[model samples]
Target: MDILMGEPEQSLEKEIEADLTIGDLTVHEDRNEVMHFLHPVVYMTNIKGLYKKDDVLETKWTSYITIFRSNVYLSIFGVSVLVSILFVVIARSANRLHRGLDESALVVWLDASWFTLAALAKQGVDYHSQGLSGRFIVVSWWIFAIIMSTAYGANLISQLSVHKEQKPFHNLAELIRSEDYSFGLIEPSITSMIFQNTKSGSVKQAWSVLRERAKTNPEVLDANPANHFKMVDSGKYCYLGSNYYLEAYQGKDCTLKMMDSPVSWQHLAFGMPKGSPLIDEFERTLFILNQIGFVADRRKKWFKTRDPEECRSSASVKPVNFADIQIAFYLLATGTLFSIMSLLSEIVIASTKKR
Candidate 1:
């Protein structure tokens, strides 16, 4: 059997119906009326969104802070303040009970706050609380500090070590909601037919949007996969297609990424005339190939270059560059400048007092 170059599905179907060639197409319920499909050789992930990686990379200075949720930060602050207040109250009471005199309220509060902050930062503090109650609170604070510090340290290391690229939209719903991306799929394909024929849901909604867009811009219904991928690489468009086809393009262009949201699954099989005698033979051959892992081996051989493990090893971890932590340097420099100003002010005040 000679391998022929693929034509448009309509022409390909006609050729198969006329008994000219045996073609491969996704086996769908609608297509079954016109063609006999052999046992599926490839079960493909269908209708996933593809977009540019550069378009979604986290660029904000605040991205580092996203390691901890807002609630976690708030809870930590609240707990630290509560612990400081408890320490101050216990120390003040112990001082009054034992010596009949206590330190100034402001001084005790400052010392307690400093001690609490030191523990949180995993630093040593000179101050030690007196009495059993005060000691118990200190021990409890230490335990809390240990748990929080451990969690924060682990999360921070993971965030810093793994370069996580963000996604602008995770699903068709989000893609529709986002105005930044214009999405389209290869027209005259089963995936496109599924979108156009769906009666409801995000798929239907997305098709409606694309239809309207296509009226103004015919490129929205492009027949060529290359055009869809080109539009995606421009950073303003998203392409939706089968994972098998998209994965090939993604391997060629590392800048492209397929969204985690898969709209459906499609089975790819060889198509022939409705009463073709070769169907049984083809089915049996495919069954043997599937059982012996030949099909899986071919898929791995084709897609191995873009395997997640290899991709992660090649690109995910890099030495943290100065630009990555530029905000930290900015904060350090700002603090140093403020400290110098405060020192100058103190020196001026001392000179004025001498005068």
Candidate 2:
């Protein structure tokens, strides 16, 4: 038989032991440990930044403008602009040799910009340069455009192929090692005691950190499993508790997940006062129950069937939203403003020279 109970705690195990010592009730020595349960496991959930939605786990979508934010992309863009400006300067200095054209500085810059853009697009310009230096610059820029275009194409293809899912922590050891996550046990519980007395180096370290957390923030020792579930959903928290309870609570919620690796194991037993006369009778009944397969049936009924809705819903791809592209819009606005200002400055200089 299985039952779940909760109460104001002073360590339930110690309370049971104290009752046995003081003769409040008697317990069976041979049948004391009723069953074995794997140690409490950790469950973590997050709604933002690396989470599952409608069953499928995925990374946040990349914004289109984000490509321009890359240092490499910006560097290439700056080089293209510089190369265009260099062409304009060369075109002016060598204008006498190709004397048929008469154009303003702004017109020269505009033409150079168009030529540079077309070259980057792998398009040929109709205009031909008379000077050897002009021809050399054009050839060099064409080679640069070829290499950059190839590199960018390869990088963009690689980015599109990969998924960016991020997990909060893979296991208990990882949870303990990370400073980003705050972890704690259901206080005054078997799992808490196990952590406090654990011989395992990783678990022991985790316990020490948890102890410090409790001292620093007394509320870190959460008494309620329900609160633990809430904390996990709220993000950046790892709740350690019995697998039985965790499975029961998270079985319905799609977002919550238990770590595959268990942190420890425990011997779960029913307790009574020492030297109780009914111990043999209880043991006999339990033996009969096990023999008839009642225990296994009960476990299969409650624990075996996990919710499949999460799995079923995970197939659909989530739609991309404005938050993903907000930064890109900001970058575009900044670039547009800067361009308008530059054009205005060029107009002012031209007008002053005419005056």
Candidate 3:
């Protein structure tokens, strides 16, 4: 837009002022198309330097939480199944020890999970369990339980310890809340922090403001097909989205335009609990990401059009269960060998019985 408009990127003062100077921008006809979802993900680029840094920081925090919940290990159903199995094993083991243990001691053997393991061990039978098939099974079961428990415990620790994920925040309101800023954002320019933001350039706060709106509206996501350059200049809602839009829809009628000067110099980082212990390491990773130009690399990927082939072949692609795929593949590969082994075993047993 700056090139077409034949002007370099303007300062915040110039950007806002230009809104009043420029003639009314035509709202692209397609801006009204309703979306099924609010823009869950926002790519920040293209639009002039209207984005606020506070808003970006705030949105990154919000997106971080949403991504955390989607991990398979964090699911309640997955965790609950492991817990239920643990309790069932403990109950069974207690019943096995009931025979050798005294009546009083047996009562204490109830609920022998990690908490009661020590107490149950101390209450062990004074007499050795002899010819105790049930006791043998219980001990073996506990051993197996220990092994499985150790493996899952390792997984849980890994899930928490090394955070490799870094996601973009889509809502800036969350950032304003985190930074404890004086801005309260609502539609059509409702903000209590107006005075404070005006005094100090709260570009972060401004961008976060758009993020909150994006979180609520699908129109912000793919819905912004309009020529929104003038709208942004007017500051109804400051949008900080990716420049991908320019490449995807570069034509005479498209709405996106880039700003010359940075609206605000922002330190974009993955958001988490404030003052987190992982801050240093995470910050280092962020630096590495910047050094390697990871964000720019992602920008390239984000700008690429969604593969039309995938969308076209959607119906043809069977929704195969990952577990079923493995099981079926293995079963087919070993089915003949297993059948031969079973037949041979049955023949040998029959011959032994006849002899």
Q: What's the best-to-worst order under TM-score?
A: 1, 2, 3
- Give a tens-digit lDDT track for model 1, residues 1-355: 5444453265555653344233436777777786777675555556688888663344456656765666667766776786677667767776765456678889999999998788878898887654555656666666666656666676667666656676778888999998788999888888888887776598989998999999999998999888887888888788888777787778756677778888777776666667867778877888899999998897677544466754452244332433443453344335334534544454466468669
How many backbone clashes does every candidate have?
A: 0, 4, 23
What are the candidates' C-alpha RMSDs? 12.3, 15.0, 20.2
Off by over 4 Å in 2: 1-164, 302-305, 312-355
lDDT at 300 for candidate 2? Answer: 67
Write the residue-wise lDDT of candidate 3 on 1-355 in tens digits: 1211211112232642221112111121121131011111123332222222221212233332332233322332342344334334433433433433333333333432332243223334222222233233234334433533444444444444433322222334333444332222222221222222443445545645556655765344333335343344333334443333433443232222223333322121122223345546655665677668786687467557444343231122112233322332233225323433444454466468669
Give the CA lDDT, 0 to 100, for residue 25 in model 1.
67
TM-score of each: 0.67, 0.45, 0.27
Clashing pairs in 1: none
> Where does candidate 3 have its weakest 10-residue lDDT segment?
31-40
Candidate number of the best TM-score: 1
Ranking by lDDT: 1, 2, 3
